[model samples]
Target: MNSSLSIRSFAEYVEQFTSLLIDYSPKLISALIILFVGLYAIRIINRLVRKIMIKRELDPTLSKFLADSLLWALRLLLFVSFISKLGIETSSFVAILGAAGLAIGLSLQGSLSNFAGGMLIILFKPFRVGDTIEAQGVIGTVLEIQIFVTKLITGNNQTIFVPNGILSNGVIINYSMQGNRRADLVFSLSYDTNIKTAKDIVMQVMQNHPKVLKNPAPTVAVKSLTDSAIILAINPWAKNADFGAMASDVLENCKEAFDAAGIVTQPYVRESSKA
Candidate 1:
């Protein structure tokens, strides 16, 4: 009879514990509902914030990052709220989140740097859209500037995507920013050709061309006498819009004049593959 009574008392104790848990079930249900509602509210708030930023003309990429970060932060807060509702301590939750963010930033330092560089480009208009520039040793026309990368269309019609961080640190040549540019031409002729005659011919060609600017006074002189040729250097300033056509025409004119005079000429080889 004593064994039976002990067993029955143990069973009653377990039953009471279970009933106690069931009685608190309403609190658990309320916590879950609060968590879901909080998350939904945060989502709505994020959308509204993004809309406002767009209306204010905030950069699109930056606005998107802000909205996503806000949403994640809100979800974390909702999680902390749920934990608190469950009668657990939440002081450490916020601290943990802070540490996590710091660790992530450290791990993604490169990406963060690129993001910062992109912001700089957008904030300061070093070169605007449709500018022809040389950057990172590649010469191209800028197509689009994004948060992480900038797109360029090369002279060969190839598409190039460059990270913003390198562009920020590296040397960039902006060729389209000036109103007028000087075309430096070094013409080579056989050492026996008369230097003064070549200069007169070049000057006459410059005068005939309508695109060449006369105010700067097209300069022409013998710069050097190489082993094979005498180099005649010429620098002419012209409106940016005339650079292409005038340069082509100048070379053609020089060839015709030299041929007519029957003056032997040396080939003008490129000293640098690119400038």
Candidate 2:
């Protein structure tokens, strides 16, 4: 009998809680309705902010970021207002929230660094989506630049997510920035091979290739004469879009031309990549 009485007394707060709300029924319901309105208004305002940012020519990534941040901030502010409507003390609530935020920030220091790095990327724009770049020791095609990480697809079919903090600080090589690219090909011939003949052979082959751009002209010069072969540097200017194609064509033509001209080519180890 004594245990039953103790349990009933301990649970009596539920009835009192109901009585308190009933006493302030009008204000309590009004505050809840205000909360709903505030949430709805935040949604509308978020959309409007996005539209305005787009109109003002902000970066698409930054625009979305601003919209999301604003929506959350405004919703929080509205929540405070709604609480105030229900007779809760706003100053005390804000103080508690401030303390909580400090704790959260302390726990997420690394994420904060990444977020700051992402903002820098948006502001400075080292590279964008679809730009072929080498960053953070990874060379790949950029797929997306999100708030915290960058997405990449490597040539070998691997997906990479690089943290913005590391990428923003490291060396980033953007290949597609230049309007035109030059293929830096080193063609080697026998040390005894006629220099003029070798130069003419490389130049003639580059000129004949349809994909090789002619506007900037092609350059062929004897770079050096090594113990094994004569190194001829072939720098051919081509449109950026045709760089790979022209590079591929040059190697094919050079091998054929060397065979036809009876010139000995460089060995495999000394061979340079198709630039």
What are the lDDT scores of the predictions, listed in order? 0.83, 0.85
For 1-275, candidate 1 gives per-residue lDDT tens digits of: 99999999999999998998898788798898998889779878998999999999986556766777688878877888898998777878768878998999999999888888887877775765677789988988888878788889997999999898888778888888986777888787976688888889888888888999988778888888776788888777788668878888888888799889877676544355775
How many Å off is the CA of 233 in candidate 1? 1.5
- Write one digit per residue (lDDT tens) for candidate 2, span 1-275: 99999889877977888888789999889998998888888888888888889889987777877788888889888888888998999999999999999999999998888888889988898887777788777888888778899889997989999998888888899887777888899877776688888888888998898878787899899898676778889988887677888898898899899989888886424456897
Question: How well does candidate 1 score on lDDT at residue 156?
Answer: 92
Question: What's the lDDT for candidate 2?
Answer: 0.85
Query: Clashing residue pairs, candidate 2?
Result: none
Worst 10 residues of 1 by lDDT: 266-275
Off by over 4 Å in 1: 1-97, 267-275
TM-score of each: 0.63, 0.84
Sum up the clashes in candidate 1. Answer: 0
**Where is model 2 more than 4 Å wrong at Cα?**
1-17, 55-57, 268-275
